[model samples]
Target: MCASPVKKNEPDNRKGQAGGDSGPASRSRTDRRNSQAAKPKREHVKKSARDAALSVLTGVEEAGSYSNLKLNQILREADLPRPDAALATEIVYGTIQRRNTIDYYLAKLVTKGLGKLQPWVRSLLRMSLYQLLYLERVPDHAVVSEAVNIAKRRGHQGISGMVNGVLRSAIRQRAELTLPQGMTDAERISLEHSHPEWLVRRWIKQYGAEACERICKANNEPPHVSIRANARRQHQDALLEQLRLGGFDAEPSALSPAGIVVSSGGNMALTPGFGQGDYSIQDESSMLVAEALQPEAGMTVLDCCAAPGGKTAHIAEKMDDTGTVWACDLHPHKKRLIDEQAQRLGLKSVRTLVKDARELAGEFEPASFDRILLDAPCSGFGVIRRKPDLKWGKREEDIAGIAAVQQSILEAVHGLLKPGGVLVYSTCTIERTENEDAVARFLEAHPEFVFDPIPTTGWPESAPLEQAASGMISIMPDRYGTDGFFIARIRRLA
Candidate 1:
């Protein structure tokens, strides 16, 4: 349910056409304008209920579960009511977000390296210290006692005693602890902030240390609940009025004419319009991709890599449910996901197919469709706010690995397009290697294809492309108030 952010740099095609057979020479530029935009930065409230928070975090680590999902499940299923559930949620998410900093203090108490310790034990210490430093509402004594109690329940009494001793010692001497002097400034900051060193390094390489810190800070922030008012069912303004009447703080998104960005109200699934098919919870940035496709009433379209059918449904909705939308995915389950969504949305134009998009050209004539959308598979780096694990889980090499697949898929799918057909290449990534670099490479190899300016008929003027590229839009979280995403519009010459 996370929205992916994209960064794009379309090749400048003056003369209203894409560059001659050779793609525009390297136009990579670090766009720091949005990176420097102002916003309320994320920060911890106070330290005390740290132990209670640590208990929840420790449980997640032991189980190898999602921090938010596990905590919410525990809250919903347990006898503990709302107040305790809220407290536990705060502790778990806060600790995971600020992991490096908590560990920096813990390393002072333990003689051995934190990495060398048992997984649960390490998570236990990190959780406890996080409460002591961040949650002012919870008292230190309660934190220590609850942590010890949980430790005893989950492990031997010996482990509980160890937990109590370690937490108490850290609480007493937290002011004196310091990171190793040999560590790089970014590494030290990243550790103190509880981020993986490798992620911090990548940010530092792309942006300076100060900017990287800000980016890291943003990832820890609580996300906003936004939705694309099913314009097929209702307009954005009408949906906003309904949402306001229902007692929600919602507003029309500035970037997308069809988007209503809900600041906060309640769970999306439980929202009034959800079951009625009035709207779907999609990020403002995501709404932009479907807009880029600009599906028309009678034009045939292909949603390659379409799974869960967010864009497929949107495209069908845009076409007024008239044209054929070949909804294809590599897996049968994913194809079923598209089928289910199309059914729920009352879309009849979509045709579901469980086929590898990369190999679909053999089954169709070249340039067979008027529009094609390749919402390709990518490293989910742009959505760290919702899936925090991605920050720690992604590697630089993974980008090259994914880029290869994206390139091949794009090339394979490109051949299936009719000579005059438009193709939208998109992804939820901020990395240049996978985005602009990949798109630039695609244009280099394909001489007949031309980059087209994304038509702005239904789009707002403020959403215009900043980078010098024809038919390309790159949305970044650091810049836009939504997830990062990259999108490109290309048309084959007739």
Candidate 2:
């Protein structure tokens, strides 16, 4: 276990000697052990879960890899125990989720800019600090020890020493660490809330500073599991009993009768009755869309943009799987996703289509279906909790651009709706332009189309309705403990 402290200033020596000395780097064994003790002990020679996570996080920083997908790949390949894998997953995601704040603190502690540091060193520090602050299960000594050991394996001695010094400095200043004050609102939100500066400013303008902070904070909190019970298998009461028996603390959603919330369930696919299609993993707000549609037996319904069809299957289930449910998406591969879900739930009436929703006019005559569901593509601001990267990845211009496409899709589908047939327009976003504006514009051009009220049963009594020219529902994440969503129910005049 003898080693030398590699220094950057020293010339490279092929002889593998420390500072050009042919003799041992330390005078005695006691001194060698003590010197090592002064910093951190290298516990594992090969690798640990922390080591794998550090490597993957470094890849995320350097290669711009998606955190969830990359982490999953690592978890699948690594042979670490379940607990260790879980810890690594938490470290990687926590660091990625709080990248801005972690770097801000590092910059305050270090003399050099964090961006200029080697990507590996940056990743090491971020992971270490994330565990130190957020992971109560991991002790401080273990955090420091693993970080130093990782540095030894991946970096020279000087880099390892610097990592130790920087982490120690962060620990000492944990109480005094504060974001710089007296800055722009965007900067304040970014620093205080740990969101990207660009996103903070955009949110500040879109939703004031107070509301922006609320949304940013919501994004950091761990997401909840909201399941939609498959009525085909069991009723809500029976499913709740089944979930409790399966070791999940379950409860019915206050809003949706079909919705169930689980406090903890490691892997949902492995849960009881999942293979038999007892329930499906979906958010509470999404269940609202199918409820608002109110499809009945023998009614023909079209789910525009329905791929990976949760709403489509729910619609079929609501109709007792008796009526035809045409699920359409632009991509042919996505059609299989809907078909698979339909087969799992034993819904024989659900059919999949690969045609574009805009061209439905040509494939079907006007007023062809009894009901239509247009869950348009959107910027997805409302579901930030499940997709944290959206807060940093989305741009201001992107919102308006998506809204235009949503409007065009609405125009195309309006003619296909039968007189007295309801069209439910929805998006997993909070932007007014996509929800309120799209509905407003549609009402202005088509005087025959009128707003259909969402039934009181579909929503909780606590929520207040805002009267709009074209009636729409804007469900913000803050209002309901669900992803941000907007739903508007409209009907064509007979």
Candidate 3:
């Protein structure tokens, strides 16, 4: 049986108001005082892991905060032990990821219907059900007990009873729970994978049903932590050896020559040589963007939409910290992030600029940069593993709107590249409309830029170089074990 994280003998923290005294007129003043003192005193309940997770979930739903950001904030404030903190993070993210499916079960068990339930109550039920359905390590009774306790403290007795009854019913009926009989293929896949039906249908249209299912499943898994070794500071081999010697399960990534996959280390910044600028934490797929640009010494590069400057710093490292790499973003606040990354990596070539990519043509001279990277903003569907809330947060219509923005940015920045220069347009999204289709539209409009094949010399030999030869690469998370990403390299022809 799983041990309950709830503390023993916790206070209920509720007080009943004084009722009118009809027959107590004869009672003595001391007797009345003694009666008042006999009532149990209300004390604040000790916070539990479930309470922290519930608070984070409610914040995400009501305040529209990002799950990762909100979860980190709550965890730090709560100062929970390691095991409890892990549980809270799991419950928060897992419930958000499996919300639709949990609601499906909840609606069946909840007689008043899930729609009528208060937002917090619905959130509580979803989190509890997520544990009952997915977290096998937690016993069902303990989940029910903890949820009931929370419902009682947060709601009235009626609400607490409702939660208890619903959870107990769910536990008893777990064997009988099933998807509706006549659900269409899209509906079935959507419910089973906890994805929006429209998104699933869109993916099916683009990638077929089997591949779409694989993509959906992959999105629910935790993302691998990979870091790129700074070539200016240390060799990849040396970094890998150093990490292993420091008791980290590190190995070279199969995708990027400069990438290292760390399996055991919790925080890469705390690892050895991190402060010395040996490496920076980045996904292998993201590292590929800088590699695709193939930056060399004495080349001017523009990284449009560079914030948190991962790829921008990588571009500078690839250039041997020589020449110039202008990193630009819309938010002035994020300029420090890019500056900090450059400082950490000891790269003096990268310069930070505060400017939107769409407005770059007005600020910079035309044909000024030898290479450009447009890591455009999109719906972020590809990184669902890292940001599971995206699965529930995004709508089908968001794709077309974001695609238009991507196209506009591409057009605005195209004139900034010098003749015979390389421009790598990439997004952490697998949607074709924002990726291949966007590139297609750009090429049709601008005749001078032509597709440039992604060089595959140092890439894994198993990579489909031929398929990616047209200067376009779409990596699926399920197939590649990396974030779903799309990259297209276009070169200007004088």
Question: What number of backbone clashes does candidate 1 have, counting pairs of residues 3 or more apart or in separate chains?
Answer: 22
Q: Estimate each model's TM-score.
A: 0.82, 0.83, 0.89
Tens digits of lDDT, candidate 1, 128-203: 6766766665577977887786555444555677778888897777556555567786776576555778767876
- By lDDT, the candidates rank as 3, 2, 1
Write down the TM-score for model 1: 0.82
Which has the greatest lDDT?
3
Query: After superposing candidate 3, which stretches have Cα over 4 Å from the reference?
Result: 1-46
Candidate lDDT values, in order: 0.69, 0.74, 0.80
Error of 2 at 264 (Å): 2.0
Task: State the number of backbone clashes in model 2.
Answer: 2
Clash tally, candidates in order: 22, 2, 0
Q: Which of 2 and 3 is ahead in lDDT?
A: 3
lDDT for position 242 in model 3? 86
Residue 138's lDDT within candidate 1 is 57
Candidate 2, position 176, lDDT: 60
